[model samples]
Target: MTDPLLTETREDEKTAAWWRQAAVYQIYPRSFADANGDGLGDIPGIVSRVDYLAQLGIDAVWLSPFYPSALADGGYDVADYRDVDPRLGTLEDFDAMVAALHERGIRVVVDIVPNHTSDLHEWFQEALAAGRGSDARERYIFRDGEGPDGAEPPTDWGAAFGGPAWERVEDGQWYLHSFATEQPDLNWDHPEVRADFLKTLRFWSDRGVDGFRIDVAHMLTKDLTEPLPSRAELELLDRSSGRHPLADRDEVHEIYAEWRKVFNEYDPPRTAVAEAWVETPERRAKYASAEGLGQAFNFDLLVADFDADQFLRIIADNLEQARATGSSTTWVLSNHDVTRHATRYGLAPLAGRPVKQGVEWVAAGGPEDELDRARGARRANAATLLLLGLPGSTYLYQGEELGLHEVAAISAEQRQDPSFFRGASFDGLGRDGCRVPLPWTASGSSFGFGADGAHLPQPAWFAEHAVDVEAADPSSTLSLYRDALRLRHLLQAEEALVWTDTGRADVLRFARPNGWEIVTNFGEEPFDLAADAANVVLSSLALDGQLLPGEATAWIAPA
Candidate 1:
């Protein structure tokens, strides 16, 4: 029989070790749904939405840092890794939420912030009070200043967001903070620091968390030498050859190797994906290697243009590198950190590449008039379909299914990201645009986010893409995602990709091992698909009688 269209059922076959070849939906808890009237999304809000997640056919849900925090760096500044933030929920609430997801046959992957801790964390507080050269201060990367009276930072190092990476203490010492000053980098060389993270892993694993998304997986260990490497040396270090003094050092893999031991001790073997930002695919695969975390995020598609050559090369390299490490590739397009792809694809081209426009582009009141929003939407839809049809795991960020765009209209006074205030060269426009509260329904000031209000403001136009509105339209992006994900569930066992030449530079065509073929048209001209309508499986845009529309993607079954 021809491959039957799959249904969104709780199939035991699609789990795929509960990680590999899985569809994991990322829920930015603060903006996903709000249960209480406190104007913020919480665990209870997520608990209430388990049914929706199961309906979405995702194998797991990766909840971004929900631990106790000061809201610095959007919960990445974790004060307590062992417990849930009171604003979000309590320990019991967390357990209940985990249980709910498990009951629905959905796994939970928590965000683990091992690279740093909140300045308000107990360890950091102790480091502050313990004075310079004290045992408590050793818990973090602290050093004496370089210049007169210690006015200068330890070295010429700069922060990930902006400014000096080191923060001066009341004492003469300075502590390193790769990101915001509120987040102090931990001393991974410290035994207790290493042991504490092991305890953290066990704490969540014991609570039934199936996996973890390691924050800054490659930045955990640093060279931390006296008279640290100069900014030029650090910046000029060849990423292809030697270890980096600040990020992606060789010693970091030792930390992850230890982590793999703990992950292996679990029943089904808890899985983890490294959020490493290394450039080379081989280096990126190291984070996902057998000795390290089992998977690493492949972000090649995120920054690339909607061109076929770029997509094909990235897909081929990603699969090859990931396979070499005996790990599955983790693919993503947009997340809480960047601008939504629908909006990103709408921007004007720069230097023959997709302009590196992020939330900042939107924040600056970008060229909305010149943006081909329709074209962007088409490309994004096609891209997502292509991503879903690939051989490995796919991560779906919240609001993408509803075809959400980056909301630049947000007022500056209401913006909350640290990058906005820090003026960091990295994602300088701030990530608040992409992190806006999701609209579940078209009604209410908060658009069904909660009873009272949302922490971040939702624009009025958000109503057009509300879940309730899209749920009624079969042609909507929401319906397209629902159908695509369900159909993908049946292809969990297929893992090989064989490229098929379409005789066009603008067309990307590939065939899965299971006789299912996928084709994407990125050119201005539409391409005629050889498959008949009876053999068509799914498509981003409805086929015009066997002709795949421009800026669209389609799946066809074997004749």
Candidate 2:
């Protein structure tokens, strides 16, 4: 019996690096499978699931931050960079998990939060204990208040989460924090700060970790001498022509360049990917240049509307930038930070804003304007097919294979995201909707995420999309992913994508070198396939005869 989902192209023996064509899975450790009866997922829980990941056909797993912290920002606030939080596991547990992943041919990439550290970090604690002018205070961005008697904040910069960026201590000195007040920004200008991160990087690299995913990579260097920009100015700054005073500074590249030397010291040469939120493709390219971090996430595709023209423009622009920098383009649909693509696709498109910026706006839409779940699922499946066919490494957030949508109804009291607590100025509802634990079993406490209740409440609907239920149904989204991934090697050919003219403005048709054609319909109506495209290998939705439905994508091979 031939599998309908499998492609005919044979796996190639190309000598390209693993990351260039790899399908990396992103795991938010706290929301993945939990092994112990504890409500939260742990390192051991991840180890127990290595077989599951291996079966899914992913080449690598990028674990979100698990370092010891107060969980002020979903573990992004790190108190200790060298060890796992006791709540998560010990250092020994981490090593064992890494060993388990490596044994299964899956590489490990851990998150490194270099821009800031938790207020409880020993360095920050010591800085507070020491006087304002002490060497201990130099590690972080702490300064005397600007006004008389040192009362006013040093700058007017606002926190990324919300409120003022500066927080005053008992001593009347103000400290800078781009995120939550509990997560203070580190002073990269200090030599000790650079040395400390180098040591931290080596600690993980020596433990055989494959790579690092840098958090807030562009905001590392800030010009303390300059006054902070106004909120309006800051919002405009991301798109403005000038360099930002607090982000994407020219000096930030120097830090990565130095780190590149550390990365090269390893045998296969460890790599780093930056999470830069710069405006233009040219600015993004600089972060992924030879002298800087090897790769930076290109999120234009993630935020673009579900239109053929928008998709083509973003794809072309990213490819062009990647080519100029000699960096592999990275494509991702969803992650822990934003609303899941499934839910995002369900909402009506916002006129003037990109999808990423319209989450709060979507949330504001009343229950009368509820999500079109069926449409969202179909579009998500098509999007994944489109993403996998693109010519670069791809990232899949956990549970996306299960077709999970954002649990938007999570109560405010149950929400854990720091941003939610910060108020409407920060666009409040928070990212908790997308970080709910994966539903493993159709019937179990917390759907088999653990014996105990999940850290974040899982909506009752999760039972229908549980792994066990999906695994039993061949037509489920999970099955589609498994089959698509098993045959993804067909997309590994190092050739440029050739656009095919479908004679319709609303349909996007492109072909790879292997005679594999991908057609996606963005119009409001079904599209009739050409005679040669009748041999369909995969379709996001069941076809209506030879017609491809709107918001659907299909992979077809030559007859």
Candidate 3:
């Protein structure tokens, strides 16, 4: 029987040693740390805290966009590929950070926004100046048609941010921007464009960065004929233009294959983890084939509502796909771009289960307060173990280990992302709630996040969630995260096989081949096992059979 994942597998399998056993920690740099006492985070800040990250038991760190840009799209819009943003720091600061991180055996992966460039980027500006009459016009797709009443978009495609996908250029011609108008999609079909991108890749690789996490990897190539539509989405195609937009483009794979070659040329093993959001498993696999990407994010698991069937299907599908093509799949639940998993599952401090054994904060009183905090820590601990138990690459967003929930109050004025301005509707407004600055103190309201007169306002009650307080308390969420990550490393050292057994869907279970069986009751109610008196290695619950609420997980070994 033919495997479903293989678009085409070659004899040579590209290997990146750092990735296999890696526990990649994704840092949205803007919120990670601010060096220079500036409210905004910079490379110097990251450098200052290199040891903090190294201690997290992570093999690598994927830093989101530090490139020079207008910040229209929160640094996704690239103004310069070779230069570090002045606001971020000088290029030397980056080199220093990389060297410091290397000393601690932590590989650094930077974000590469290849699909599009900021309107302020030299290339985009040049393309605009060249206009409809020049060849540069081919750099981006241009169409001529009267929109609604000669003013609305010609198609019904909406922007991922929340507005029309097409923007009328100064020249009076409509240009396609699946995201913000400031972020014009690049034409990968152009030979010059491809050459420029390769050069950019080379530039970064020469700078000694370990690898790149290609942003919106699937959106690089688009269907020029039928632009994306703008309206309420009924089908997947309705949401995205009927055109493939980016994935499975022959040209795209070809370009990616060349990028693979570039990475191979580096001295040490380097990688390129593609952020491809293709819905179909087949399409996702094609991007991860030996000739295409090193690994692609399996986002199907991220959006999957908590359920046994969905969780099992996700693992099985990805495992089948990756193994077929001899490629790796990236498993993750939350990122800076979406609602945090804890928040998504409605794990808010609401009135439901017993308050004492719940994740709610109450006035410091009897053992009930201690029990509440303990339960919250356990919920976070089990969830982390569950995600880490899955096979293939896993991405842990910053502060996720702290079990951070989505902050509720982010007024329109506080919103800084450009995606929000583009989309008229706030459905899936680029995850600002989860991307807010990290909490690091328990003394003041700002959580020691900023000095007085900072650019970004600190959220109210920030101090309550600071790392200092959590670090001091052994049972705090911070300690739980550190312990869980350390546990994953230990499991790997024991030669555990993180493989998938497609026997049950509703019951999310995995084993080490060695007696360890990790299982989760993704659904409500207790699940009895075939084995009698299983050795419960770890559980989200107490000895008493109280089913820990949503996403409750446990680890066991057959007696």
Q: Which candidate gets the maximum TM-score versus the true structure?
A: 1
Model 2 lDDT per residue over 320-382, tens place: 677677778899889988768877777666354332323334342313156788887888888
Best by lDDT: 1
Clashing pairs in 1: 360-429
Candidate ordering by lDDT (highest first): 1, 2, 3
| lDDT string, candidate 3, 121-210, tens digits | 887778778877678878776676575435655566667777777788777777777788888888888888888888988887887888
Cα error of candidate 2 at position 99, Å: 1.7
Clashes of 3: 18
| Deviation (Å) of 437 in candidate 1 | 0.5
Which is the better candidate, 1 or 3, if ranked by TM-score? 1
Better-scoring candidate (TM-score), 1 or 2: 1
Per-model TM-score, in order, reads 0.94, 0.93, 0.83
Candidate lDDT scores, in order, read: 0.84, 0.82, 0.67
- Estimate the TM-score for candidate 3: 0.83
Q: Candidate 1: lDDT of 558? A: 71
